[model samples]
Target: MGRAWILCKKMFSLTLVFNALLTIACCVGILAGFYWYYSGWNPFAPYLVNGNLLWFAIAAAAINIFPSALLGRKLHTGRFLFHHYFYGFLVMASAVIYVVLFTSVPLTTIFLVNNTSPEVNVGRFFLLGGLTLLLDDLPDVSKRIESGLNHIKAGANRMRKVIVAAQVVTGAFSLYIFAAVCAAMLTIPEWVTPANLILVFTVLITGVTAFIFVKRKAWNNLIVNGEENSH
Candidate 1:
């Protein structure tokens, strides 16, 4: 009775809306940015439409809605809260400020500061946003944030074989996230150009998407199945 009640309550709650609006945007931005870059090399190149993509992914990831969901989950589960989200915010804030105010070191303009060049400055906000997800992982203290894919794995198996197959496929998306980011991260940030902008955007968005995807998926399971802990 208790389990059923919890599931029913969460199923149609604002949680689902918040999940899509706030958290999924993180992943969608990453996917879209990768799509922009992958109009050739990646598999989905031919399938997705072209977008005059903007650079708001970094800011959205930094905003409280994104981290509040991730860190809020950690806090609820008795994990280290302050270091992860607070530092995450600071990293993103620094990224925004640097990109807006100090992307190029005027004192060292002779080094290389070509906006038209594909090689970005490499060390500014373009690179800094990568640290948010890295810091979010408090692995020494616990598993840190629980995985959403694992929750699907723990779903009811006795009901049907199809459900098990679905679980496997769903959990596999995590690999897609990893592979997509690896493709982006491997691209050396050397100049400031459209492609380079997208690359840095990809790196930062990956961190945000990965963190939120894990947290949002797990919470979704809790809402839909009332199964918080995976067996």
Candidate 2:
């Protein structure tokens, strides 16, 4: 399982995510950059309103994509509570921004519907809850689900990217393993004799040769054969 999960981008960096100043900087940069890039915005919502399939896909992705990334990472433990809450706050903030700035719905109508507790904005709560669920992937529940989805059924048409992954893993894993072994040889003086070093280099060269051969074989089909990748 560990070997299989080597490909996952856990995003567990504390410096990148947990730092208060860095987080604020990142948020400001993203929002300001996007606003500057597009002077005017049009929420031509469901961009292709004429096409139900496209609209449905867009809506589905908007609601599900974040959850999918979280699910793939499976980051739902006590340690990740900060991420959970932070992302939750982001969702609510986004909803609030939309409501206050762009929503055509009246504030009174949005709030008056809540009878349980007038102080508790039901409208905001509904949107907040939705955003929280959509973003809360609860990754630990299905830690390996991402890898499982990656193992797509192979076919001539679908195998293009998969083949590249296989080839790279084959070559890269070999080099990575050999590099560690070479590093290990230095643990103790005179532990790795000159004879052993020579043998290791010989094996390393052999492995690299195989990697190159497979790479060229791939190029033969990808470039020499003049076949463009599938969209």
The model with the greatest lDDT is: 1
In lDDT terms, how accurate is model 1?
0.37
Please report how far candidate 2 places residue 184 from its true position, in Å. Answer: 60
The positional error of residue 123 in candidate 1, measured at the CA in angstroms, is 6.2
Task: Tally clashing residue pairs in candidate 1.
Answer: 6
Cα RMSD of predicted structure 2: 21.5
lDDT (CA) for every model shown? Answer: 0.37, 0.36
Q: lDDT tens string, model 1, 56-105?
A: 33223333233333333333232244534455456656655555565454
**In model 1, where do residues sit more than 4 Å from their true spots?**
1-82, 104-231
Model 2 residue 155 distance off true place after TM-score fit, in angstroms: 27
RMSD of 1: 14.1
